[model samples]
Target: MATYKKRGYKPKKEKVVEEAIEETFDESQSDVAKAFDGLDEAANKSEQWIEKNSRPLFYGLVAIAGLILAYLLYTKFIAEPTEIEASNELAYPRTFFDQAETAAGVKADSLYTLGLEGGDGKYGFLDIASTFSGTKAGNIANYYAGISYLKMKNYKEAIEYLSKFSSDDELLGPTALGAIGDAFADINQPKDALDYYEKAANKQANDFTTPLFLFKAGQTAMQLNEFSKAESLFTQIKDNYATTQIGRNIDKYINSAKYAQ
Candidate 1:
């Protein structure tokens, strides 16, 4: 009770600390205003740099556009027309090839020679393949060239031309594949030869060529000591083309394969 009569109020120190904090905040606001002004100046400089460099950038873009247009025009106007002209020039060689197919011995040889010789000029077979590579006749000439090369026993050249010749005709396509097998066989690459013969046999599957190639493939497999493969091929001919000449001869190969095994 005696202490309560003398009690009096006292101000807290926290109000002074709050006043100091408010003063620091006021100073920090001025610094923030100065930083924003510096950012505005940097933005102005960036705009100036872009404006100064825009003309060169636009010129570079225009030059690239012009190069693309020139290339397209050159391909369309110059390259395509030249190809058409070259294809027209290959007509005679094609005629000679057709004639050679029906002619016999010396006459066929002469026509084939003429075809090869005539295909040599500026618009010749070689030129047509090189220049008018898009034409059908050019491609046909390549096939003829390969066949001629094969007959001449120029196996390497035959392979080159035949590799380039592509067709969907059932007879010619398998025949060409068979010729490649023959060329490989001539060079004594038996494994590669066997592969191509099998490919030829399976490609078109005609009674004329398929059984013949299958027989050849079986023979090649026998040469390579692959008795099981040879037996399989022979058995396929026996089962699939039993009336064909190769089919009739299949039993001999089957026996030979079994003997080798």
Candidate 2:
């Protein structure tokens, strides 16, 4: 069995309050902003009008400021408190996983299973994912559960959990895609695996992950007897990533693909 490994699973810092509230900019309020658009005209044309409307403008600015402050207060007081509580609940499984993994052997896999399905008064990642889907902690649980399934060689369940995992992170996003490729490959679905490998390579376009997935994609192409595509993907690593581990060993695969062609 080809086992999948993931980057260290840690609680991703949540910036949801800032990011979520950004969408609340209120396009409907554009009408109010338009009133001040001709401030140049205000400066030159209408001292009397300015004096007459000054009080209302003051009230409008004050009202907008109030709305912003109120939102910040709500996020700080209400949303973040719930976030902290959820994180606290998840800490047990997360810590147990780390300890078991470091111990190595069957214990690690058993702990991963335990973390997915809790017992002994400990909550599992699945519990956190289901009960607190709106929180940042819940999102992290989905990733944990998916990787555990991949390690267990349960491909269908791996796909199910990994498909739901999403992140804009430079590493995790590509990693999730690559893990999906590994799952597909294990099930003799090389074509689907190749697609995900290509997607993972392109997801973040960086040194560490991109070349890794490109290498995996090249291997998958060879499995599908796609010699020409395999040659291209292999040559890409040789040309661009000569210092990477895969790049250093790329010549053997490229030569094989060429010979097959």
TM-score of each: 0.62, 0.70
Give one digit per residue, the lDDT tens place, for model 2 in 194-229: 999999998997789989999999999998899999
Candidate 1 — what's its lDDT?
A: 0.83
Cα deviation of 106, candidate 1, in Å = 7.8
TM-score, structure 1 vs. true: 0.62
> What's model 2's lDDT at 64?
100
Following a full C-alpha superposition, what root-mean-square deviation does model 1 have from the true structure? 8.4
For model 1, where is the 10-residue window of minimal lDDT? 1-10
Q: In model 1, state the lDDT of residue 134.
A: 60
Model 2 bad stretches (over 4 Å): 1-74, 103-106
Query: Which segments of model 1 are wrong by more than 4 Å?
Result: 1-88, 98-111, 119-122
How many clashing pairs per prediction, in order?
2, 0
